[model samples]
Target: MEKFEFTKPELEETEGILNHLRDTINDTLKPDDELRLREQLMKAIEEGHIQRDVFGLNPVLQALRTAQIAVDEIGLKRDGVLATLLFPLVINGHQTVDDIENKFGTSVAHIIQGLVKIHNLYEKNPIIESENFRNLLISFSEDMRVILIMIADRVNLMRQIRDTEATEAKKEVSEEASYLYAPLAHKLGLYQLKSELEDLSLKYLEHDAYYMIKDALNATKTSRDAYIKSFIGPIEEHLTAAGLKFHMKGRTKSIHSIWQKMKKQKCNFEGIYDLFAIRIILDAPVEKEKMQCWQAYSIVTDMYQPNPKRLRDWLSVPKSNGYESLHITVLGPENKWVEVQIRTNRMDEIAEHGLAAHWRYKGIKSEGGIDEWLANIRSALENNDDLQLMDQFKMDLYEDEVYVFTPKGDLLKFPKGATILDFAYHIHSNIGNTCVGGKINGKAVSLREQLHSGDTVEILTQSNQKPKQDWLNIVKSSKAKAKIRLALKETRAKDGLYAKELLERRFKNKKIEIEESLMSHVIKKLGYKETSDFYKDIAEERLDTNTVIERYVELRDHDSGVRQAESAENFEYESPNEQFTRKNDDVLVIDRNLKGIDYKLAQCCHPIYGDDVFGFVTVSGGITIHRRNCPNAPELRKRFGYRIVKAKWDGKGSSQYAITLRIIGNDDIGIVSNISNIISKEDKLTMRSINIDSHDGLFSGNVVLMIDDNSKLDALIKKLRTVKGVKQIIRI
Candidate 1:
């Protein structure tokens, strides 16, 4: 890599941003490391072709600003800073993974690569299904810094969105941020970022609602300030008397959050209560933090009537994201509800900055806090088999967790609504495979029983019991489902193999080679989608051997051009010993010799060579062949049984029979051309004519084709059915 010199104007802007970033992290970063980081940032900007606009705001400049925010606000380290700086180059297609890894180290390069993969997934599958979204989280789990950088990047984008002129683009970005990024920020415990992202997104997505709430909040600000002062005065005095050093602040809810409450409650803005919260941050040592929080909570609840249902005591057991607070909703003056939150100063920092602040404040690299959560997610991803990878990832990321206890009193957490079978599998696969039922809280229950928090479950197992296919539907965990599917598939594969051996034996007795080609032919003729399905039917005795033999013979004979034909021509009575040789052009082979007999095909049924037929002697015509299942067959057969004559085809030569088919489909442009293309691909059929009519965006057409046999015609019809815009096809 070569270092490029920046122009005087570019150098000035770059130096200014770097100086601000250095000052913010002067205490944290080593002096030499700071200089190196500055050099790397300057080089990346130059190589990336970053330039300042008339207002001195370019992509590179924006990236620097994001880096500054990540350090000063988000509490990120060196790797995160590098990621923020280089993410712009990756997004704009200016740099590759190799370039980043060679110029920087693997740590920074890997983060950028993961971010790029996520970006590509979103771009390629914009209407991302839940499964793909889960995969996005799994990508995030690879490195915690990836998400930190992403949040910082989004915060900067939301801040600059007012400069965007495209209304549609703004709406799309805002909707995505609202639906995905904001919830993610909240889940990660970054309350400040979550609030900002939601407010910015609402400003774009629901402009009217956002402004209305904003204006309402502004109008009430003066009165709200007065109320807050009055409400907190008593609590502040009590806390000061308790000798607790603390700072209190009144926090208004974001406009977006207020709008959400209004919509959810189906009320006007003024009808909503508790639009703001009061926070009491105690300056306490680590040992006294929990005690100080509860003390504040008691003081507030005593001064006002507390809602029992709304009290959340996280001091005992913090959230998975390490959020610890004591929250209580109280009825205050004027019968209005006010939510009060109490936490120590350290807890407040963790709430604002999330995992980064926790790690920085704790001074540990890989600890038991967030790393444990990441480990569990990785474990699920590694063990998953049947369920989609994204689904497993989503389960780990976003699903509500229920904590259950084992018989030994060991607590285990699982996704809410997990069944007893999921519990059994969580213990061990063998235990699940042999599980019959379980006892929840010492009461007998089926495996399908949904476990709730704090329930003690004991799995009952039988040595002879194996997993059933239906267990898949009963279990909610991906692990149990994967195990059940694996067991069933193995059993089914074995059965299929046995069935194949039986079929092969029968084929050998008939002196026919049951090769792959022959198997494909038989499977298709029998209407089986897969060879395994055909074999399974045979092995399970669901298919009759005689039916299989008959179909096989038919397929073999068809391949050899030995079609068994039936005739519908009648002849005058002849002597018992009489015999006659007929020309091969005769469509039907008459049982009785009928030399020079004047006969014609029945116009009503238009019997073809492959059709079943019988002869009917007409008074005017010599004889006419009528199909067995023809519309007039029953009447004719009942009226004149004696006049019927048995007939058969010579089965020696081939000739084309004209057939008309009706087709209907949407009237799309070039639909006829598409149908014609399919017809041209079939070598066994000759398209004689076609007529199409289009009306009201619908097309109806009749196609006239000349085909050799029923099989060829059937194949042609199947092929035509696949053409684009073709809805229906029927032989007329």
Candidate 2:
């Protein structure tokens, strides 16, 4: 760990931060609360707890700065401030939650506990696969205050590390701040803090881009200010003439945002317009906030041509995070498009600091919706099978909201790009679990169909249509993805148990006693990651029970040494289905090999005329041909090594073999008709049987065909692949 020594100037700065923290929390605290517990927190940190962090910064000072950010910058209350101060003590085990709760209160203690859980989960590098990171994200979300404090803490860390010598640590912190916390801050409506975090993160993570944008901003500072003055002067005059009480100002966009626009637009800094936005904060009554905002909007548009496409009306329906603003882009002087944001003073505070400030207002906080969204996030993290889901979930934190209607005309908000399946889950989990498809605007649509704004969606479901594994790919909402995974996991478990029972019955029919350890080895050798996965494949009919039983019997007999060989060069041993041999010619070309050896192609693998084949010497002095990847290949090669012989296709290969091919596609008459037509068109290809079953709009079937040579087989497979909606076609 890199250590930072406390110097004179650093100590002076720490004192100032400490005083600022105390002053910010004084108004929120009771008369005796801060004087009593504040001293206790600092003393505990000094005497029992860690005096310095991994970076050797003074613990008390860092806590004060973190607390100051939470209280002053984030607009968190006394509990949030105190929890930020007390977290270091609890995380270090010097103070317990009970002790803090007795002195500070339940809210403070709860927040402190949450903070400790998160702080303990923090590592220099965190892998999303680990349960720790998943828990870390989900735990803090139960309380929105916790997420705010965490963002504040991250901002404090990012701000403090710029001059530190810990380059690698700085980069990790910067990356997390940029990728994770910035989105979170934006979601919570802390735009000022969010932009600051993004700017600092870019400075550390992408040094060149950060500096280039900054330098270009500095280079154009004079002209940008002049243009802003010219633009704002007219808006200020028009709004005042209309007697709208408002103060207007122009602020440049953050360096990070500017860089993003440059990259997105594929241009240099100068090539990008609208590098800054104008804000008009109105001093208006609560009831007239919207009326005055529009009045001011009309005043501005009267002077400047408003770009109707760029207008965003959030005044009527504020964001879930309590963000209220009217955003529009108007054509100002010089044919330039300038963005303008208009909101009330109260709206401005809520916009800048989020619902934390809205908590003080009457009927302004949208905690219920934000709470439900966070609950969905928490649910998604539990049993998260994919680490990429966490990244997607984080990006989902601030996704643009899409407003759509249900069949009953109820309006619902979803993340943009959410599909019909996601809407089903959004309504109810049972609906989502059994969802097959939907009707959009009274038209039939698949579950994968993306919902558009203003469309009426009525989810179509069936009790028999449970969530399939592919449902995970169809939904865009985190709630839908998480619920699908849970459903699939439960279904897999049930199938695994049922398959185990079936396997036991088959084992009994074979009269084989299954040893637990030996069965484990068998499943491992069969290439299963987990025992459940082995049984699941059986339940899904991906594996044959007869194949498994044969494997078990082979393993049992091998352990008993019933097929022991004296030597590879002289021994001739035979198992039930395999034979042994002595050395012969290096290759077996079927008809040309030995001229007197009779051979039979193995029925297990159904080796065709043109297959990459091999030969096994039989007890009757004949060879059994088998394909290389035959199910029994491993056992044959392992036990009867001396009998193995190299074989390959030769000459015209006019012989025919019966092959079974499994085909699956959409359940359409034309699809099946086209496949049948193609097979009948090919000469020398006879379709013996076509067995198909249709269910849930999909058709799956197997066709046994007598086909000559692998060339013909390859051609048939290619033609079948070209069939529209045919998902898969493979020979069995």
Candidate 3:
């Protein structure tokens, strides 16, 4: 409404800027705004303050150099902005700039140079780790100007790339900029850069969809613009009529935002109606910003029907990322839903640029400073050794953020995909290792359960319990994943050693000599890829002691065939259960003869006479028998479990007993024939269902038979072992 004017020094700087920007750049600054900025600059200079280099160089001096360079590089068209932005870096750091220029050629600008430096620095330590380091980098900022310039440089590139012929390449650049730079810009409160980068990037990455929506939007633009103008006119009129100083502006949604709505709602372009929005900026004191916003909302809704469900009150508390605005969707004229965002201009700037814009506009507030977030990002970059920092950063920036609560109600934010386990681990490694379970909002939940916002979680821990291997499946944080992996590995190593000691103690108690050489063979025979695996399996109760000992014996014998005879000396079973053997008796006498010379069950199978039996000579406990289908059969076949010695019944008659066959049936009739078919197929032994009374036609029977030893029993039982109804064969 006023004519543009500037002070002497301000006009001088303006002329220099205009000389460079006149033909090339579109000046978005209104005439009045330009004169105001120039006047402010001159006033600040007169008041003995000057814009300084990031290193504190006087702005007047920097401007002078920048002006000269812009004049020298005036003919450079495509990357003119870039060159102007770079002049400072070239002059300030000659050698460094020369090296970069040599490597990338002179075409690269100072802003690009700064970007490359920051990029390389971030690339070097890409993971956002220890927030401390990031804070240290920022808090020690000599001038903070370099970082600001670098950010501006990226924004300019984002804009410049859009106008280039390499549209596809620029699209990729924009996407990356959005993922990394835009968030950074927003985090820093650089709203101008943030909005432009987001809109431009969204345009290229999703062009067709963007334009389709854009066209649909354009079709309604005229009517919608008029409608919004008419809708807001009364509010402006009412505020003006009330003598309240305020600024009202239209807020259009970004393309990326519109596309997200279409994707989320599964809607066509035509389905989207509320594309146009409004923002009400008020001239008010900091304390009155909220009150005025509410007053404005009252004015808006009073004139038009408002959707209660679409009302969002963010003025009470801003986002952790520093976004604040009050949003309301109103049913405007023609029954169309029109959204409005209400904030102070300060709030609007912060919403758009984030922390960077805050720095430019209001400086940093001590309570919510940029150092805090930057420190977090830095910490993530540093502590993440398992992942490349770039990869972690890419994931870190793109991931949706979740907010959890500390025990004291303070917020603990994590990536969206993080789980309770991650939350526990994030608190402390000791807390994580001891964490057994957790309560989400006073309700007990699994550690693997995904966490959500507003969840007040309390981790349950066991003082003695360690992390379980299954935690690997559910943990999502890079830190948690790495810590859990380390803990599991360390625990497994300890368990393996414990298992080895246990086996050693068991052998020592029995006076069984298994040399370390033969021990390795036993470990390998257990199908363990590593000795540690074998030991851990034993400690975990996954491997049986008998199998290990027996394997050791077999390997010992194989290594030296001469040891075959010595097997008898090593094979001694001093069972605490058996007391029938008399003192000084070399072998127990059964039915008047030494039982050692008579029929015996093989210990490998522990088979009874009626069982699919096998027998082996025990070095001390006479002879032991086992079922032919025993788990030890494979090893026995290879070593001595199957070393069946032939013997006959002492003619003292038959030892009629029970031989149990585990029958697993489909709960159907004639399940016995299904079982008996195999027994009948064997033709060597007769089996009767001791338990099955043939009721309901589904029978699970145990066949009983008297036999000499395991001679033909193995073959007969092997055949029965294959029966359709027979799930397992155990000699009882």
| Candidate of highest lDDT | 2
- TM-scores across all candidates? 0.53, 0.57, 0.42
lDDT per residue for candidate 3 within 515-550, as digits (tens), equals 886787677667777887788878887576655776
Q: After superposition, how far is residue 244 of candidate 1 from its true place, in Å?
A: 2.2
Root-mean-square deviation (CA) per prediction: 16.1, 16.4, 21.3
TM-score between candidate 1 and the true structure: 0.53
Off by over 4 Å in 3: 1-116, 119-143, 162-172, 226-230, 233-243, 285-287, 301-324, 330-337, 349-732
> Deviation in angstroms for 307 in model 3?
6.4
Model 1 misplaced regions, further than 4 Å = 1-14, 26-48, 51-57, 90-95, 362-732
Minimum summed lDDT over a 10-residue window in model 3 is located at: 70-79
Each candidate structure's count of clashing pairs: 4, 0, 41
In the range 1-732, model 2's lDDT, one tens digit per residue, is 333355787679877876776675555576777686668865774465555654556766777788788767766657777788788778777789999999888878888878776765664435222234457656665565677788888888887788877787788788778767887777667788899999999998898999988898899999999999999987787788788888888888999988886764456887788889999999999999999999988888888999775688899877656679999989999999999999999998888877666554443223232344345334433433333434454544543767789888898888777999999999988999988899887778899887766578999999998888667767778888998889888988999999999999988876788898888888988889898889898998777676577667768878988764465556555454543333665788875343667877777778887788789775445788989778778777776667688887777767678999999876643778888999999999999999777654568999999988888999999999998768899788
lDDT of 2 at 598: 85
Rank ordering of all candidates by lDDT, starting from the highest: 2, 1, 3
User: What is the per-residue lDDT of model 1 for residues 1-732, given as tens digits with 9 covering 90 to 100?
Assistant: 333345687568777988887675555444466555556556666675555432334666677878987776666666667777877676766677787778667877888988888888877876444446556767776776676677777787778767676676667777777776776677667778889999999888888888988898899999999999999998899999989999999999888878886754456898777788999999999998988788888778888999775677778977666678888889999988899999998899888876566766776433234354444324333443322433333354433767789999898877767999999998998898888899987778888888876578999999988787668867777877888888777767988989877887877876766557765787887779887888777877666454466556656777889954546453233332332222233444743345777776665566666767777765433778766766667655553454567666655327677777899987655789988998888876789999887644568989988877667777788988887678899776
Candidate lDDT scores, in order, read 0.73, 0.77, 0.59
User: Whole-model lDDT, candidate 2?
Assistant: 0.77
